[model samples]
Target: PRVTAFSKQLEKFHVIIDSELAVKMLRDAPSPGKNWSAFLKVDCGNNRAGVWWKDEAGVDLAVLLQNSPNIDFAGVYVHCGNSYHTSSSEEVIQVLDDTIERLMTFVNHVRQRGVTCSTVGIGSTPTCRKPTDRMKSLTELHPGNYAFLDVQQWSLGSCTEEDIACCVATRVIGHYPRRNQMLIDCGFTGLTKQGYGEMASGYGVIRGHPNLKLCKMTQEIGFVESLEGKLDYSLFPVNSLLYILPWHSCATAAMHSVYYVVEGDTVVEEWRPTRGW
Candidate 1:
């Protein structure tokens, strides 16, 4: 419906097909605008979606989609999401290279069969960031998390702390001097329940306070714990403001409707984001 609503301005939109049935459905579906194409999603290694790379069915589906007159074959795309599972940059690059090699071989096979495959889209933040050189065959890189680097991205060596852009600003609501812990107004509702990769003890790090971490939380309250047990409790009194770097910026940002865009300490603008499907 949204596509039809804006059909006047939409020149082309490509839908990803994971199976032969999806390709058939896309081919049969009425065009929403002037040009609509289909992208065959091949699972190079991710195992998340798309037809498996070694599976002959995938090639058959691609050939079918390419020959279909109603839907143009926009080529194949693979999202190597498992790239984040690697422990180091070398491993990430290896996964990306392997994925790309498989994708290239598949495209080559399709071309050998007299099919005109043009675009080969590949992306995953860790894979894209770690690759020493770009794959010449890949037409597009669609790394989503690169825009707002999260703790996971930093842990995966995909980005650094300086590259992180989003954070949660919370105020101290309660203090536990005896346990060296304090309660902040931010919780799962605001900061989200996501945790940093391999850093099991805390959910997120407090900006500028390397030893302080948001360890636990309820619906509306976050427990700030001092990692070293040497934190001066006097500094964080009631109503004191603190900024929390989110473990996963995408999930955390989804909790808010409008972004409070700030420049230095002043609110410069308000940006509202799209919501719902």
Candidate 2:
């Protein structure tokens, strides 16, 4: 309980500090050992959590902890979530390079002030997969999704499309003559229902469903329309199963209680991964 309830137990139940709330807790917290050892979070590039690197507040908070009696400033932490915005190899590389340079600069500056800043941590799946030498100064690497990478990881070149081992198989249910739509049995429930719809291949990009476009979806239906508007799909028989590539693979995985594993002409077994609280 000392470890799992908190995040930075990687250091053996280490009570790692995080957020402005954590920082405040440390300021008033009692010393447990030589010090209440903790890590400081700075918004190096990822704005999701931690103190802002540009806020002056983040740096100041770290400085404050170092001088506090109850807490031992173990080190600093950060993640470059903005790196996820990179749409290409070159852009991903540049974002990684620039992020490391900036974070390390903060660490170097902190040291010049006589504070014993140690752990200079940073992360982002893309940056880690394509590491840069600037990160040699870091104390720890915290990457969450390295275990089972997905489509987003594939698009960023973090992992290949083949490395993505998850998908959904939904069957065609009906063809609408009035709206020129093909209805699939999978809706938000079956296909892990999600999409940016506006994108060329939204509502889960179909692998070989080439001439097809998923226009919209309801709770138990997928509206598959033709992008060309003239191509004939009358050949696809009802009840034909369709394989789907999820928009947010991580989220889609959450909806399934069990996975039906299959091999050619054989039913392997049922595989179930754990889920939400």
Candidate 3:
């Protein structure tokens, strides 16, 4: 296990523990010369991961982590991913409030049992972007995708179109006047087909082209058509570049190995994202 092999190197890092089996794995792991610091991931509302907040087994796991000599129970961590399903900032705030309430209640229950949790946190770009007064009680807020917001975030009212910091720049490869469609170099592999029905503009929002819609995509080709009437080939000639604001920036970014940091028509730097889980 990486934790067992590189315990010293990861002494400062906190691992999230959700189930009793995971706790057992950490306890059974070869002694890393130091106790593993961990946070109990609680499922406040987002049912994706973590132990259910109201489940007694969740509390038992917390207690087990606290009592284990091989592990140190740091606190609680929650991801309010359900907030992303909402359509407005108000709905996001409601999810935020409910998550905080549930998290605090669980923390209180843990505290009643003499388990001291030093950290209480919740995260999700939508909930974090639309903060409520109740969020003040949390010790930490982790909004990971706020760095490169996308159309999904905009649809959830987490941010504005201008706040989307990244896009896929594709070139026109072919023009189909008869079918009223144009082919682009970037497809599902490049931009990802994430926002299917979520956006009116289709897969992604074509920057500066309100009338254009990305109707379909193959592995390496995207079909773009006009939303209004006829396809204008003269406006977008072959080999011309078009920037598309992806629906999910995280998925789109994973398709590329390197990112060019641009500044006012000039590429000032290059960033290579770390690969692997």
lDDT values of the candidates? 0.82, 0.71, 0.90
Give candidates' CA RMSD values in order. 2.1, 4.4, 1.5
Query: Candidate 3 on 1-277: residue-level lDDT in tens?
Result: 7647766776465689898888998888788888888999999989989989998888888889999878889999999999878867888888999999999888988988889899999889988887778988899988889899998888777778999999889999999988999999998989888989977899999999999999999999999999999988999999999999998999999999999889878889999998768
**Model 3, 184: alpha-carbon shift in Å?**
1.0
Per residue, candidate 1 scores C-alpha lDDT tens digits across 1-277 of 5654565476677678788777676666666655457888889889999888888888888889878766888888999999978899989989988998899888888888888888899978888887556577688898888777888898888888888888889999987878778899998999888774446448887888887877788999999887776568788889999988788888998998888877889989987989865
Off by over 4 Å in 1: 1-9
Each prediction's number of clashing residue pairs? 0, 0, 0
Sort the predicted structures by lDDT, highest score first: 3, 1, 2
lDDT of 2: 0.71
- Model 2, 1-277: lDDT tens digits are 2423342434443455556677677666543334567787767676676765666666676777788775778888778888788888778778778877777777776776778987777777777788767667777887655655666777778888666666788888887767777888777876655556534766767767666777777888888887766536566678888777776666777778887766753669997987545
Off by over 4 Å in 3: none
**Higher-ranked by TM-score: 1 or 2:** 1
Residue-level lDDT for 113 in candidate 1: 84
Question: 186, model 3: CA deviation in Å?
Answer: 0.3
Sort the candidates on TM-score, descending order: 3, 1, 2
